[model samples]
Target: MVQDVTLVDGAGSGPAAARIPPAPLGRNRDFLLLWSGASMSFLANRVTTVAYPLIVLWHTGSPLAMSVVSTAALLPLLLVQLPAGALVDRWDRRRLMLVCELGRVAAVGSVALALAAGRVTVAHLAAVAFTEASLAVFYRLAERGAVRNIVHPAHLSTALSRNEARGRAAGLLGQPGGVLLQSAGRWVPFGFGVLGYLVSAVSLLLIRKDFQQERDPTAGRGRMAGEIAEGMRWLWRQRFLRAAFAYVAGTNVLFQMLALALILRVKEAGLPSATLAIVLGIGGVGGLCGALVGGWVQRRARQRTLLIAGAVAWAVLIGAMGFTREPVLLGALYAGTGFVGAVFNVAAAVYQVRTTPDALQGRVAAAAGLVGSGTNALGSFAGGLLLAAWGALPTVRAIAIAMAVLALLAAVAPDLKGELPDDGTDTDAVG
Candidate 1:
């Protein structure tokens, strides 16, 4: 028989806020280790992500092969997230992360070896991509949970902000790093991934703290489906979270479409590809800047205010992009949107982490991610169709209008009016 569980009441929990504060994040040794290792791994993943298609195209000269490998890499985000979340909650998270990193070393290393031996095949590439991505999913989920345990609750927002910035920085550098490395040799990026994963594994080994709170062994081990459901049910009960995630989903879709539209706009205007790259690079810098300030913003702004304001800001910026074609102007406008997005992500992550019980952290994070980003592919496909039918200008204007609608809804939504309570504590129980 399944045992009964009482999930932490996020809204009502207050004791978490009273916990003793830890050292500043800069001086926190474990956080630094976690950050450095994750930063390297994230950068390496970005490098390989860029290289995968380049290598596929260079070798096979087939768009289909490139698409197959790309799809394999993305498939894990859609497939592995939920089960991985469940397992992360059930397993030793640090060990799981170590295993993931080591697994990635082998998976990515195989590709490098194959490429060097001139034995690389589409099937082999697809398999390796899928394996590496799957491991990454697990590692990311575990790391999400692990971060809360290693830091004090008071610094959660600051810690997450730095992490967000690290990710943006990795993306900013990794694309160019991948292209540069690929120019030297197709196998070089994969070799980098192997090295990065090894460093990440070492970092995991050095972390001495437990990744999760003690579990009740007597609470009968539940089925994976039940565990996932428990997390979903908890999440669904929080009106603020539900509204926040819905807003996030809408904005995420709009951003995905906007990115594609930007590329098409550049091409249609007969601008050099370098112009587009520069605009995107500027936007990446904007995101990094926003992440750097996220903790300060979160400390001052109410959650409801931030969400509504960010949406409105996005509406204005995206609308402006629809009317402009000048490269500098376009880059500045896109940068504004990126800035808002990074800040919004940091705030949302802080809220989620501070309120979730340690045991449910992985599952909750996975559910939120799935809800927030599940429609990205659909958005990309719809953007392509819209651009094909109505051109870039019209499609972008339509998205701006949609964003405006989202903003208006957020402003009036009863559930989003007040601040969400955060006790800054982990509320875990077995069912």
Candidate 2:
């Protein structure tokens, strides 16, 4: 009788095939749960985004004050990036997810209470949003590595593609959902926020230890600073990853400019906030379509081809949006941009996870994210000044042109053209 065999494959420990299963199909149950948890969390996040802004604007009626809350939210990326990623490398990711969600529950729960008690101030709102977003970085860094643990090497691309889609969904639905809830009643959104965190926590419970157990080592000791530094250094060596990070960071700047221009244009035209929300909300449909098609694109399109196409599409769609004030027309343009962004984002996440060592996923994600936060901030500030100087439509056109040029340049990265360094690299199957 033929006997069943199993193997521990890492660092040249087994036949590469045994260690690296086929890019995971739907075979990994635990991975599905993890994706679900993160996806729901993303949707909840979008749903709640408007609660704080609406509350602040409603209470204080000052755009500048609300803007401060937005800016303060970026501080945590600077503060926690290094330690967070290092710790994520060490921590039991499942436990970390549970803990982070609970911490958020407590923080937002307190904010909800304070709001109810009439003690919520601009300062209070800023602190809560910053804390929530900060903890998210920690939970996400921990989860990124944990993904490889649950899924086989074969499934990584599809898994990441699905993950990226959730992000687009969050933007598509989350922002508008938040706006909708705030319209119903401010406190209603907070109640919904609390529930979303609870849902995330509950999903974590369903992901069994056997399914979610990480494949990476949690051993290694150093001063916290050194540990963090080590993670960063490892990521820098990967040629493909470095280019992806730069590409993402640059495009984010363009996104901020577009967003700021949209705001100014609406204000100048005396359009209702509802109109902006609805059009942008519908624009999210493009992201959904992009995400749905991402897996097919990954399988058929060369990496470089997908990236170049996505970048070009992003520039064109955003440019089209610049010329439209009609609600339906702008919605279509925004949706198309969302679609292109989904394709670009999903493809990039898959490439990074495939290229980077499992040990470095958290730090790599953190560094890339840090770049995004800082660049987006600078762009937002620039957007405000541009609006004051040349008006909203000009700013939009400028961003569109920049996107086109950046995409053209970034399209030339060697890996995107199929010189992928990790195309056949067999990595540990992380949970």
TM-score of 1: 0.94
Q: Write the per-residue lDDT of candidate 1 for residues 363-397, one digit (tens) a residue.
A: 98999989866989888988999999999999899
Residue ranges of candidate 2 with Cα displaced over 4 Å: 1-28, 59-65, 121-123, 183-186, 209-219, 266-273, 322-324, 411-431
Model 1 per-residue lDDT at 226: 94
State the local distance difference test value for candidate 1.
Answer: 0.85
Best by TM-score: 1
Local lDDT at 231 for model 1: 85
Model 2, residue 110: displacement in angstroms? 1.7
- Tell me how far candidate 2 lies from the true structure as C-alpha RMSD in angstroms: 5.6
- After superposition, the stretches of candidate 1 with alpha carbons farther than 4 Å from their true spots are 1-21, 424-431
Error of 2 at 139 (Å): 1.4
Lowest summed-lDDT stretch of 10 residues in model 2?
1-10
**Residue 255's C-alpha lDDT in candidate 1?**
84
Clashes per model (N, Cα, C within 3 A):
2, 17
